[model samples]
Target: MALHPTLQAVTERIVARSQPSRAAYLAHLDAARVQGVQRTALSCTNLAHGFAAFPANDKLKLREQKKPSIAIISSYNDMLSAHQPFERFPQIIKDAVRQVDAVAQFAGGVPAMCDGVT
Candidate 1:
C-alpha cells in the first residue's frame, strides 16, 4: 500500500530521528501492519453475519479461501494486544478474538487459519 503523503512525511521524520539505524523505521512499518490486523479484524466482524446462512457448498468455498494477509500481519498483534501494548486492552483482544472465532467457526474454518480470500 502506498503511504499517504502526510504519513510518508511523518515516517521520514520519525526515521530520521532514529537516524543511521533502519531498525526504528522497520519497526514503525511493522507496527502499522499490526494495526492493520486489528482494524481488519474489527471491520470483518461486520461481515460475520454474511456467513451465518452459508450452505455446505459455501463452507467449501470458504475453506478454499486463501489465508488473510491480516493473519500474517497480525500474527503478533494478538500477543501484543494481550499484553495491552499499543494501547490495546485485554478485553479488546478478548472481544476481537471471540468475534473472529465465531466467524471462523461459522465458516467451518479454523480460527485465524484461512487466508479469507476466496
Candidate 2:
C-alpha cells in the first residue's frame, strides 16, 4: 500500500536527514560486533576503569560479568509534560532490576522534543 503523500514526504525528509549518522552508526556497530562475551574484550585495566565508580559490591559483580547490567536511559525534561513523568522512572526501574539481581545504572538523558511545545 502507498503511504499518504504528506506521510511519504515527511518520511523521506526524515530518512534523508538521518542517513549520514545512521549509516555511520550502523558501520560502527558492525565493526564492534563479536562472538561470545563482549565485555571481556576489554582489558582488565580498561574494565576496571569502566566500573571504578560503582559501589564495591557492584564493582565485583560487574567484574565477574555474571549478573546482567542494565543501562536506564531516559528523556526526562521537566519542561516537557510528556517527558516529565520519566524523571521518576530511573529509580523505579532500578528498584525493579534489583529484584531480579541485575545491576541498573542511570546511563544518561537524551533530548525530549515535543513539536507542540516548540
Candidate 1 local lDDT, 47-92, one digit each (tens): 4554445455544444444322221123223333353463344335
TM-score of 1: 0.19
Please state the error at residue 37 of candidate 2 in Å: 4.4
Q: Which of the numbered candidates is closest to the native, going by highest lDDT?
A: 2
lDDT of 2 by residue, 1-118 (tens): 9999999999999999999999999988677553323678789888777787677877777877777678888767777676667678888997898788767788787664562433
